[model samples]
Target: MADTTTGSTEQSTVPRWRIVGPGLVVAATGVGAADLVATLIAGQKFGYTLLWCVVVGCVMKIVLVEGAGRYSLATGRTIFEGWRSLGAWTTWYFGPYIVIWGFVYGAAAMAGTGLALAGLLGGLSVTWWGILSGLLGLVLVWSGRYGVFEKVLAAFVGIMFVTMVGAALLTLPNLGELLTGLAPRIPDGGLVNTLALAGGVGGTITLAAYGYWLREKGWDTPSYMRVMRIDNSVAYVVTGLFVLATLVVGAELLYSTSVAIESGDQGLVDLGVVLQDRYGEWAGKLFLLGFWAAAMSSLVGVWNGVSLMFADFMTNLRGGTSEDPDARAGGKWYKAYILWLTFPPMVMLFLGKPVWLILAYGVLGAFFMPFLAITLLWLLNTDRVPREWRNKLHSNVLMVLCALAFLALCVNEVRKAVVGA
Candidate 1:
């Protein structure tokens, strides 16, 4: 991998169209099974009425991610370094946040992958399949190189694109109604759901991993700025299409019916069954395959991207630069986080996620998007980023909108967590 510490002073001789590596990985990693389930539920509940929210959500992610990528390329500094520069509190928050977040997220990702697998090919229980999925991710990430990892993520994205989009097309949605959904309107009692669908589309802590992926892809300078923007925009466009397709499936398949899908990843399994009954075994199987791709892509993406972040965190905590060997992919700290994301979470699958851990995950997870949005608003506006590369007036407005949207989400999440506890 190229050194992430120093900006390449030399301009790239390569054409801009050729730059599409890390963005695809980050976008794919951001939209996992949970995102699919969320979109599907929105479609099921409100049909195409909230389709505009999906588009809005995609736009929000594009702005947020672009900010992150621009910070890295313009400053040639890791996001963690930028965060640490904010204050000692940033470190205090991120250290515990990552540890708890990874511990909970690993098991969840594994279970999600396993659920999809079990839905497609029966025999093993979801828990066992989840354990197996976790192990598979661990091995693949442990053994794979960054180039190979990107290729793997690309393959998963292909499968997701084809399967989910294909499934949506099969529904033969009403074009007029779909187009009308682009108009801003909310159904009765849809305020919360609308906010959620808009706020939650294609978001996760994985947003922070974009810069790390950029560094891994060797795009580490202001010369790569246009390419990074194009890459980010194109990737999110693909993501928006994928998410929109999922909504179409839900709207067409379940909107007229009284069927209710349970929440969480199992809701996807329920949707698969619905597809099987409504269409055929083949249709259901295809959806399950796409589900597996989505889950595994997240697994691999997190395994690589967030592990890179953790490595950097450890390096910075020790006063090492971003260029430290321990902070790069395949370094000891990087591998350590991969192991951390893979192994300890398996216990949660077998024994059930501890109640306290679930609560902590909820609270921490709630804070992250707001944390990211607020920090980006701060980082991109200051001298931390080059003036020319700083947030434009429109970019600041969108980012402020993003911050408010996510802060609302954070409040909702905290309320739900506390009430449920």
Candidate 2:
């Protein structure tokens, strides 16, 4: 409830719209290739029936991300510092999770970016493209200024939204069926798939990265809370629309055709081929390009945003603060974590991820959202934040619901990974 935009000569001097900052970056970072593929698969199999899930996904993200930004502005503490205040249990879980998650995620994100590029430029190998994508992200982030990085990310997001959303418009699906998708109903064999699609859509560990980006944007106090909320709401509305477009395309074109999409990014490639063969090569090419933009933007977003999270993790774990020289963005610990996220993971690209490493990644990845929700539940309720800035009854209830929903999905994720179910 505090106004971070207060006590500012710049607020009166500068243009009001210029305040759009890290909220956009964080939202863009949250939607990657996997998310797009999930939407595409939902569209392909269920038509617009799963469109409601996209809406729910966007709402869930808004709650979690807004919570992140709120905590930072309210407490003037980094999420790392906030988590540590709760108890050692947070730091203990986060320490291993950050390291292991980074190692596995780097390779996966690079490959997704690479896949999109390879599809764009015909006959190129995915591995080389992946490396190129990774390098490009590294260079942009390494530049060390938040404004420059945010603008670059914003440009990529523009390309992705325009192209993908345009494709959906071209499909021209029936408005009646589209409206029906807004209803929350599940069909046969859809319980698990519905949950997965609902949970997976627009959800990622990157949700927690919002606060760090806010700090980088200098929206560090309660005055910017309203601005942050508006920014977050607008960004996710765009995201929800983009995902809805994918669902529309899937429902209109593939539902009755007996054309099944493969799981993961492969399904998107399948979509490209079908689009090209059926609608013309240009359609295929445009979708693939948009896909690349989505994938690469996410890669850069994660590489940049999550690196901030990991950096803060190390800094806070060692009891550092926002002012501690070693804890700052360009400081030793920050750069060190960035390196850990980038280089070591390249080994897995060649040698294949070890079974144990993959297991650890899956188990930890499964619980990350719930971990965030539960921690936010505790953090927001605690005396650390000013009483007025604390969560209202509605916010707490939504978070608790978000926590339970994600926890149930986490159990399912563990079961799937462990039992190969």
Highest-lDDT candidate: 1
User: CA lDDT of each candidate?
Assistant: 0.88, 0.79
TM-score of 2: 0.95
Please give the distance, in angstroms, between residue 320's alpha carbon in candidate 1 and its true position after superposition. Answer: 1.2
Clashes of each: 0, 9
- How far in Å is the alpha carbon of 111 misplaced in model 2? 0.7
Residue 377 alpha-carbon offset, candidate 1, angstroms: 1.1
The alpha-carbon lDDT assigned to residue 4 of candidate 1 equals: 23
What's the TM for model 1? 0.96
Question: Judged by lDDT against the true structure, how good is candidate 1?
Answer: 0.88
lDDT of 1 by residue, 1-421 (tens): 1112232344356555557778889989988998888889999998999999988998999889998998998899999999988999999999999999999999999999999999899899998898888887777777537788889999999999999999999889989999999999989989888888887767578888999988888889888877787788899899999999999998988885757798899999999999889899999999999999999999989998899999999987998888999999888999999999988998888888888988999999999999999999899989988787888888899999999998998898999898992
Clashing pairs in 2: 2-222, 2-223, 3-222, 3-223, 4-222, 4-223, 4-224, 5-223, 47-251
Q: All predictions: root-mean-square deviation over Cα?
A: 3.3, 2.2
